[model samples]
Target: MSDASAVTVAVLDDLRQESEELDLLVAGADAARWAGPTPAEGWTVAHQIAHLHWTDRVALIAVTEPDAFAAEVEKALAHPGTFVDEAAGELVALLPPGELLTRWREGRDRLRAALGAAPPGVKFPWYGPPMSVASMATARLMETWAHGQDVADALGVTRTPTARLRHVARIGVRARGYAYLVRGMQAPEEEFRVELDTPDGGTVAFGPEDAPQRVTGPLLDFCLLVTQRAHRDDLAVRAVGPDADRWLDIAQAFAGPAGPGRAPKRGAAGRGDAE
Candidate 1:
């Protein structure tokens, strides 16, 4: 049995730290800042945070009522197109600032324990198939890194992806096929290598060495852009060759509709690779 405890622990800690960081980033910003629009359509900083909180609420239900819980998510998404905005507003206001922070911390702690104790074979109906607790924890970490990008951008704060976020990047790289299929593209042939810049300016390379396609850049930037949190235009990531470039274009870090992704824009300056 793959014990997911290690990752569960890491994920929980990352969430706690970033949540605390977000509190710091948004603390001085005005309410308008919190309510500021993010790249996510119909989502603001508050809405993204609310989405995290709301997800925590639903994810808690995963251990037992996974199916029903996911269905509720579907129902929520299925609401009339315009309702997304209205629903986001309602959810964003669901918690008072302090209470939300408290719950966010407490809930993630509980989440660690839950994931650590989860049976490897327990299946989540909506997510489909039984997942080991490792997969479950990784999934959450993926969510945190992606959404945290939303908060970081709204504040114009450049967030360097931490070493631990590699787990998140790995998840994104592994999702390549799904990304292609999602975009109605033929999953490419030709093996590829992902050469990513670590949060500390080191490199972690994945895939076969001989692979012609290589993705190289700050790991955090790649993850953020891939997951649709930070715009590709906002980060310094390079896709060598045509196949690699294509992946960057339609990379969908989350499991939803193909989002609006564009070419690299004039990204603001940030800490360069320490190396």
Candidate 2:
């Protein structure tokens, strides 16, 4: 297969796998469990699923209706800071757990179909810059895994880390500059190396081999840090050099605001945050 085709296949596989794992996790939960609080402050399991569904719809619009998607982006920009959060809350409040799950599943299926049909090398507009179909698919996978973590934590369930995290880790490393740019800081000129130990007893490395700045850690810890799912103090990632240190503090693989990530849970025990 060509490189682009390979990327599309890998991203789709990861997306489907992540969704299936999350589906099994919430399959038997009652309504009360869906209403349980997640690590994201004030966001319940229902909210997590709603957010994913809403984004899936937005992505579908991006791929299929460029003008409409542009208009929606303009609307979001007009309201500025509060629109996304407000819209997400409204969505979750309107849907019951079963309905929310159905909506998410349907939207994701549509999104996958749309992505598959997209012409090769075509770019889809997003809340940020436009992304190629492969990058768009990978972004969806990253979001799915991150939100799934929230749902898993809300239910106090342990998730088996998978090799799919390699995609998230790669995104995290590539977004090094974007993270600094969003914070209005000048991204460092020096190249930084990221070394991660994956769950399958393999290592994934990014950036130049002899770069001065480096981040080294378990894949789970690196993924958690970049996704803003856990506090830096709660993760085991180690950074060398000033740029690497600052990047770890503000690492964001996803677009939008620098989130007020989860607070360090000093005494919380047996949770997945630290691992």
- Per-residue CA lDDT of model 1 for 23-102, tens digit only, reads 67665666777778886766887777666665666666776567567666676567734444565577667765555556
lDDT tens digits by residue: candidate 2, 8-113: 9878878988988898888789999998899887788888888888899989999999888988788788887666667779888898888888888999999998
CA deviation > 4 Å runs, candidate 1: 1-8, 26-32, 73-77, 80-87, 121-131, 262-264, 267-275
For each candidate in the order shown, give its overall lDDT on alpha carbons: 0.67, 0.85
Residue 78 lDDT (model 2): 85
* Per-candidate alpha-carbon RMSD to the true structure: 4.6, 3.1
Give the range where candidate 2 is weakest over 10 consecutive residues by summed lDDT.
266-275
Task: Give the candidate number with the greatest lDDT.
Answer: 2
- Candidate 2 regions off by >4 Å? 267-275
TM-score of 2: 0.94
- lDDT, residue 54, candidate 1: 59
Model 1 alpha-carbon miss at residue 144, Å: 2.1
